[model samples]
Target: METKIREAGTGCGCPGNNAGALSSSTKGCCSPPDDVSGKYAVSCCGPESVTARPAGNQAEKRRLDIEFMYLDLSVCTRCRGTEKNLEEAVSEVARILEAAGFEVKLHKIHVQNEEQALALGFVSSPTIRINGRDIQLDVRESLCESCGDLCGEDVDCRVWVYQGREYTVPPKGMIIDAILREVYGGPAGAVHAPSKMEALPDNLKRFFAARRNKET
Candidate 1:
């Protein structure tokens, strides 16, 4: 199965970039927001463009080359672990597909308003989509951000309590595995590709893959 892709549209009642005008979406990073729209936009990589297929036309037959969109922001230091884990996972996948000679486009969602988040039906930050489908398996903990109270026993506003420990977020490995399962059309264990066995050139690569595998 292919992932779902979300595109930013014109004049969606959100803020505009520097020119004080509404600009179209750019790959890698989203345009800056002129006003706060209850959402955060992440600017990273460099400005590139990706073609968006109409939502109604997704079933057209084509080769299954993958395009990934990592919805995040630059100032999300509070969520760095989630972003780092996502970046590391994407890098490893890029290496694999690059070796296999398949092209992939990595885009960033610059959140400027609730519309953007709602556009993709995202429940929280650090959402990973292959094509456009959310691969993260677990539902995010519900927290009342405004009240600073746990929405449930283990669900705090921004933090999560999985077992005994309360954390700002879940481990990156767990999130990555969720995306892997969504992208590969099966559970991570079912694919069993030995992602760590792939020839990686750096510590982060091994670090993230090993962590993700451990989660699986």
Candidate 2:
């Protein structure tokens, strides 16, 4: 089969056409800020997908699936920063993985509502999963001013913990380490799959509800 890529929500209203500049007035969830180099842009107002096949016609190639799910890239600073870091990490490893006969696929999912969040088993805003496993298993969150402004209410976004240090935006090294571990294997008892959530977390529920109320 020929390699195919499908993307959705590529054209949701966002200021500056996905410019890197941060804006407190941006009105939607689909906007992804451009990186500093002006070379990378993620257009995700909804769910977006990309499948990159290895160069050469091989009958079959190993696949590496990466999913980035976020609540609001347009205004959520945490989400925007995480998205940038994730993209960088992927780019850094793309050539190496491709040369190793791995076909990389990335899915950028914008969780706009409670139902969507529940459906994706999303427990927090701005999550990264490699091969169906969350890069960080423990979910923690802190108040997000940008998102709070977007919805007219306070909201909590993800906080990444690496080596006992908490960061609002996940470090590139932490993401790279997770990817390498998934590809090359980690500790003997590492969790290889994401845990299922029965319901959307209350924090997310509040954010979604507040956003809906604001839009109406």
Candidate 3:
């Protein structure tokens, strides 16, 4: 069986070297904001780009690829809780997946700097993807004290919505639902095509810059 874990600096075959300083832009990360009464809040980031695919040959065995991307898992409560839920969800379904002839692979990615965040097409902290498809389509964010302290500036992290309710950390059932959807097609199994973007969102750029300055 083939499995691996990747850290931020290790390179994930993203296109080009660090683009250097990020430029100021009026563009927001995702689509335009809707009315406050709407079910979904305005997303903090743009549509996710398919930055990775399942590793290894599919002809050999069925494969399930899971990627957990985040910033500061150690201090960010949101990131830490999300990771824990993801792990438990995977464990609960592992045996059933194995019996059904599926091989599961999990990759934990830590976004350390601006260069890596840009390369990974990361717009928000604490993202989870299955087979390169984001579990939650809507990307909402709220102020994260932990991440803000880590970078020495105000920062916002992802907020998850499940069954019409918003949560700081994604529910375990939501993660399992996403994984099962990838494994077995259903009405909601439509795969969203990844979109292209030129630069990182200003929100993320600020976070990275603050982190770098503090470290130096």
How far is each candidate from the true structure, as Cα RMSD in Å?
Answer: 23.3, 21.8, 22.6
Range of the 10 consecutive residues with the lowest summed lDDT in candidate 1:
10-19
Residue pair clashes in candidate 2: 30-44, 30-45
Q: Give the poorly placed runs of model 1, Cα more than 4 Å off.
A: 1-78, 142-172, 175-216
The runs of at least 3 residues in candidate 3 whose Cα sits more than 4 Å from the true structure, single-residue gaps closed, are 1-60, 186-194
Model 3, range 72-182, lDDT digits (tens) per residue?
877999999999999999999998877755677788999887777767666677888776667776677878888888889988888887998788899999999988887
Clash list (residue pairs), candidate 1: 3-130, 3-131, 3-132, 3-133, 4-131, 4-132, 4-133, 5-132, 41-111, 42-73
Per-candidate TM-score against the hidden true structure: 0.38, 0.68, 0.68
Cα lDDT of candidate 1 equals: 0.37
lDDT of 1 at 204: 22
lDDT of 2 by residue, 1-216 (tens): 111111112111111111133235563455565344434455565335222323333334566777899888788899999999999999999888767556667889988777777667777778887766777776777788899999999788888878877889999999989888866773322333434556766777898889889989
Q: After superposition, how far is residue 140 of candidate 3 from its true place, in Å?
A: 0.4
lDDT score at residue 211, model 1, on the 0-100 scale: 33
The TM-score that candidate 3 achieves is 0.68
As a TM-score, model 1 comes out at 0.38
Q: Which ten residues in a row have the lowest lDDT in candidate 2?
A: 10-19
Better TM-score candidate (1, 2): 2
